[model samples]
Target: MTSLTVDRPTTFDVHSPATGTVVGTYPSHDELAVEAAVDRAHGAATWWRTAGFAERARRLDRWRAEITRGRDELADLVHAEMGKPRSDAKLEIVMALEHLKWAARHAEKVLGPRSVTPSLLTLNHACRVEYRPFGVVGVIGPWNYPVFTPLSSISFALAAGNTVVFKPSEYSTGVGVWLADAFARAVPEHPVLQVVTGGGDTGAALCRSRVGKIGFTGSTETGKRVLAACAQRLTPVLMECGGKDALIVDADADLRAAADAALWGGMSNAGQTCLGVERVYVHTDVYDAFLTELLDQTRELRAGSGDAKIGPITMPKQLEVIRRHIDDAIARGGRALLGGLDAIEGQFVQPTILVDVPEDSAAVTEETFGPTLVVTRVATMDEAVERVNDSDYGLGATVFARRHGQAIADRIESGGTSINAFVAHATIPTLPLGGVGASGFGRVHGPDGLREFTYAKATTRQRFPSPLALTTFTRSAAIDSAVDRLVSVLHGRIG
Candidate 1:
């Protein structure tokens, strides 16, 4: 919660989490600079939206190719700044590319004008609905999955014909710059995309600026501050916040597959994922076997410097938070099957799995953005489902069951639920992705994502004169009686 400070002014240094070396330096921007960038973005949006969906699609296709052509460079920036493994970084970019492709290819079909059936009372009129651009959008991205998170909003906004001003996390400003620079190369005519680098000050400024919409990806606490700041201008915001997602295993589940998913889901990306599995609920029938397999598979995973399957924690300060959570779990009578409090060392925190952790303990209740999971046993699937839904944060959940996977998934309160797997549902382009309750409101993927950046406008055209012109002031008592008779004739039950 402490604010970012600096002894050196004018610019800030981005330190590598894996090694304390300075990876990059970016200009420390201020409110004035943010206003200017938003102004330029809005000006470009004037011409960009007019280009229509086809022209925008062509430009976006070129942008997508540019990203693909230099994917290595982009992925490297992510690894260097965020300390995620190169392969993991690549997966993030590839997933983002899928979203970009979907936004571009399907924008016209989902957002273009489409006719709707006229009501029986107004049959003489024709109605059509279309979506329009929101002009300028400001995207404040996170350090983890830098390219993927911000691009989720930027790609959709651009495909819907809106210009963007992006402010990536201070930890990954270089990646943000690279993305904007690539956008410029694709469309050289306009400043359709711009980057302003700084800490929270710059982001707060963007929220208060004249942008029509703001898309933010970060913690739930930060999301509230952003929302309150945007309220000054009444600017609509899209918030993708924190989550304490749960993975459930049933009695008849595939034990091997469930173990693999539990380990990967809980420990991947150093457990700094919003949809990471923080809690596990397994039926007591297979609890011992499942835990044996989970711990056995987890032994192969390591979090340390160089060539490790998992990398260092991206944010340096999260080390203490992780340490405290592990300690609290132990103090509350939890047994560490894999790792204990001593697991945290500087930027690296080894994978830790706790058993019998109390439900009210901080480790089980809070978003421990670390490589940890709290596993517990339940008597039945109903108890598992009830326990998972108990969290205030419900962004996503994974259900692993042979006979009741879909049924279990249907009852969860998150935006996206994967059956027998964790996070693969996101790969499907048509599934709307977001969260419910404290996880966040509004969606950011599929048809809903394309429409999220635009406003809907409905049009009603006169196809012919209406027989009962009830809207006109020139109507007589006889016309009113005729309308009443027509309504009665259409709906009267012959009793």
Candidate 2:
């Protein structure tokens, strides 16, 4: 509802990728400033943790309402800062609101104390497990889908009763400030959410400041550094590194649907999505049909400054990566089905599609992080699944078979999958979103996300005295023998 004006001697200018004009300026937060923000968040966490889920949920719901009310202002900032279409920016905000609502509504149910079926050996004890807030959570977010990505961790952390200090990418600091500003309005008494604007040094400061946990969303290479830095304090971390996701089209799949989903998944937001579809594996039986339909859909889309289906690449430097991957694919026996190397003139990279790219080419192997898709024909779904699984990154996958979508998706080595569509899995709050291997670890939605920012505390209380107790030092040797006999009676068959 309001803008947060952060003051510091040092500042960084945010330039619009679409116009190459200065859009906004943000404080270049130093290590001390970052520490101060975390210190404030630490104090806030204590009060928030004791606020109980009911109170916290009320505040969260209020914040969500404010976000919905301020959608246009926030969406304009998102478009100016990240170069995403205003509509797409609003979608991100809506998705974030849904996630926030889900988190607030589910916190008590997901994190509260619950009776656990304790081991039979400890039947005399009443055992229960509960999740506790980790005091403070540090979030290092990405520029693409800034609102949705950062809040994926922030909302869940807050719902779990942890105060959060978020450092959004240098590009989207305004959006972060707006979100925190709205939060301040919702809960005026405590600084439950804070934002620090800066680059790498400030992020490192947050990691070393001993925040209870760190949630980072960025590149895998950078994620490794975040993980290593957190090891200084043994601080727990959850990483949502970008992924080189693929869309697989089985022989029986609806080719039109596959092409439609692939185009939207790969080209939306100018293909700046972490789980953006980078590769396509179509069964040979339908490979030609799928490719034809994909190109047809792509032809209807364009990347530009106006109301185009896509927008410019938010990160200017990524243009080089996009060009490299396209060049590598074309130079190494791949044919450009649609736009190719020349399509990228300025900040905008027109939708580019390649066919027959070598499996080892950078276009297929590495994360292009651009609006480009590499299509490869495969002999069968088996080959498609194997090729998709061979990548080091496993963030998300899409299977387009109506009949066998679930079966084929089950074999893909990714955190989540969408049947007949891509990117839809992200809207489901109950499905945990994260990646395997190089795509990074830890989740940011669902129950797994609620637990990501908390610590599990297990407790046991004596419900009744056991006939033969083993935990007591006062127990006799005959009692120990009796315990052994009980164990033997319960487990002798296994040994």
Candidate 3:
């Protein structure tokens, strides 16, 4: 007779995807732990909300300085945890810091109480509206961008006067702890920002807990599950999900510039970016030239651990998905101008460029979050716009045209469109970033992002008595008639 036994680990190990070495180990927090973190956040939120914008801004500035001083250390940690190039990790930190600064500097003017004009019918009353914090917010982050994506939500929520209980991706648990520790160095008074490290169960606990709002970044399928779990508690959620983003190259577009942007946008971060360029639609007139340039640029790129142009895929399981997409594309008659299935070498996926890919193929329609790109030829600019708009994902799009750049960008169906550039919207602090359709909804940057964690508080006060008071119990018939006449006079003009 034989017997077998299995044991579950209470503390899970985080391994570097590039090296297959354990980088850090963290406790897998259960539901109760998540609830406790939320409780602590609630207490912190009360003080944080009352601290006034000036005080919060001061503290945030200190936090920024702390991060700046420790930028290299943090970037190294990010690289170790998620397998991104140190330089790329540093860039994410820089962008995230910029967003933090913008949120701190603009919070008061954006969310502070402001007077609004009273309606004619309510002329005797003064009206004002303000955005109030939602107390404690729960943020479930992603691994692809361990720092930037989560900080985009966390900074805005904090600036809007809410404390955040962050559940960082299990793959990036170490980086999440580093972020919390950095904030503590700046503001040690309260646990204004905290991290709970774990996997799906931990995130589910955060969602089910009594947080004011939730900000989630992941795949559309996982986002749907998060939304469903939040539904049980009726918790409001801001979803930042997946994207099958596209880049269009017009006939008059600069072949060199478009090719350069496309190569970087598609291959950076190993093409794991939610807004990364997965599909490139080029006008038939210049398709060959653009392809030539893109291939030349892509060929010079290499994927490896230290000092490589492209880093290894952060999630091991994602390698299989990438391979599946590549195989499916080749089977569907797509020709690989660059690397194909062979590009996915262990954890490292070398840059791949595929041409003649069908619009309905998985590589084009689904999100192949790897260093792979599928370029398709279009008959005209109109055809390019139609094909880009036909995707299930509408997160972002880019248009490259000399004369009709703006017009082409305006016609693309996406949450944001970049003209003659790739992902320029994400770099700007004032622009909101999110997606539409299967890409998910709710923005996480700009003014809209600040308000996503708060609710509008509207107030009205009587400045003086109304001559025709209509709400009095002792209203006379003559006064009612006068009110009716006023309403008719105010709104009776025929169109």
Candidate 4:
């Protein structure tokens, strides 16, 4: 086991939230080191892509088994680095394994060749589309839900036959290294996956690398910078940026279930999730009842380092942002039914709920990536829907209407929506996961995810000659006139 060290930063500490003691120090990688790793990955990807779908699937299955067998050890590493509860960490690992398995099983069907009908003009030639792997893929991951988010990109990329170079968030670099080690053991013959540990500079280097594509999950502001960096090389990107997602409650909705889902979805991992529910819109008929239930569930959430209901905020800098959101909400006349700005201590921010906050307040319009939520009352379902769609970020949304759940969900302009549940669509394993507008673009789940790392190649084979010859230098004026008449009869109408 060679200790991976670089000339960049020597020692960055990871502190234990439970004890506030330094736990570990990670070595950071420099540009030269990152480029070398990507260079190796490019060669490996060429070989791996040529191995065909069956061989890649077999390798992925073996990797999946290895991950399942060592799930506990891996979960422990995640818990130590990210300060998440052991159970939650285990759940993240399990979901990542599920994604790995799903990608392997479905890649062939999703990315395989398909025949398409040629236009009448080109009927003399046959046409088909085939997906080709991008040589190397670069993944910049987030600390919150570290395993699930990064693997969501990497698994799909690998399944599509691209090698990966991942730069995990600085807070969870150890866990990222562990994942790469596991993959190396499972597929020692090829360096198909590698981890580069560092802060923003390393991420920037990766964006500027010669990789075929870049997938990033982080704040919208940083996502903009990443897009700018990747633009230098004209590289394509799949960015899962920040989201201030909303949950709509109709007049006949179930308040208890909605409250439970909202509380968990908003406060889990200290609300560090990109798709966490940050806003709630409820009809005035059950507004009081819904708010009461939501506060009750929220007050019971305890943040600590052990087997607590919630963990500390993974990044230290986020605490200030959380405090500012609460302060802005309070100054704008929003009533704090639960916790307030002072509730944020160090890395842990107790669950805070604000009501009566103006729509123009920062808490309502901005991405408050913390354990705080804004609740507002609406007179009708249409108003609720309108309010939810007003934000620029449209990552994930929830609808709690029994009769019109699907209809309401379809109306929301978001990447994904759950009917009567929160974050349930993420676990379904068959739907696309991403957002529209400022929430960023591209997808990292299901068939869309499998295709994100590959380019479509259209192949046309000329077979027998057609009755009327075209695409030849010897074509006659008579043939051109006949083609025009045929097209007019087939598609034209006298308007």
TM-score of each: 0.96, 0.97, 0.97, 0.97
Task: Give one clash count per candidate, in the order shown.
Answer: 0, 0, 0, 0
Taking the tens digit of each residue's C-alpha lDDT, what string does model 1 give over 1-495?
Answer: 001223354888999998989999887878877887887787788899999999998999899999999999988888899898888888888999889988999999999999999878899989999999899999999998898888999999999999988889999988988888888889999889888889999999999999999999999999999999999999999989999999999999999999999888999999999989999999999999999999989987899867788999988778888888889899989999988887887788989999999999988889999999999999999999898898899899999999989999999988899999888777777888788878888889899998899999999999899878888899989999998888798889568
Error of 4 at 165 (Å): 0.6
Q: Say which prediction, candidate 2 or candidate 4, comes out ahead on TM-score.
A: 2
The residue pairs found clashing in candidate 1 are none
lDDT of 2 by residue, 140-177 (tens): 99989889999999999999999989998998888898
State model 3's lDDT. Answer: 0.90
347-452: candidate 4 lDDT, tens digit per residue: 7878888999999999999988788889999998889889889989999999998898888898999999999999788887788899999999999989999998
Q: In model 4, where do residues sit more than 4 Å from their true spots? A: 1-9
Residue 402 lDDT (model 3):
96
* Deviation from native of the Cα of residue 340 in model 2, angstroms: 1.0
Among these predictions, the greatest lDDT belongs to 3
lDDT of 3 by residue, 1-495 (tens): 000112353788999998899999888888877887888888788899999998999999998998899999999999998899999999999999999999999999999999999878789999999999999999999999988999999999999999999999999998888888888888898889988878999999999999999999999999999999999999999999999999999999999999998998899999999999999999999999998888877777899977997998988888999999999989999998899988878899999999888889889889999999899999999999999998889999999999999999989888999989899999899999999998888998899999998999999999999887878898899998988998888889758
Worst 10 residues of 1 by lDDT: 1-10
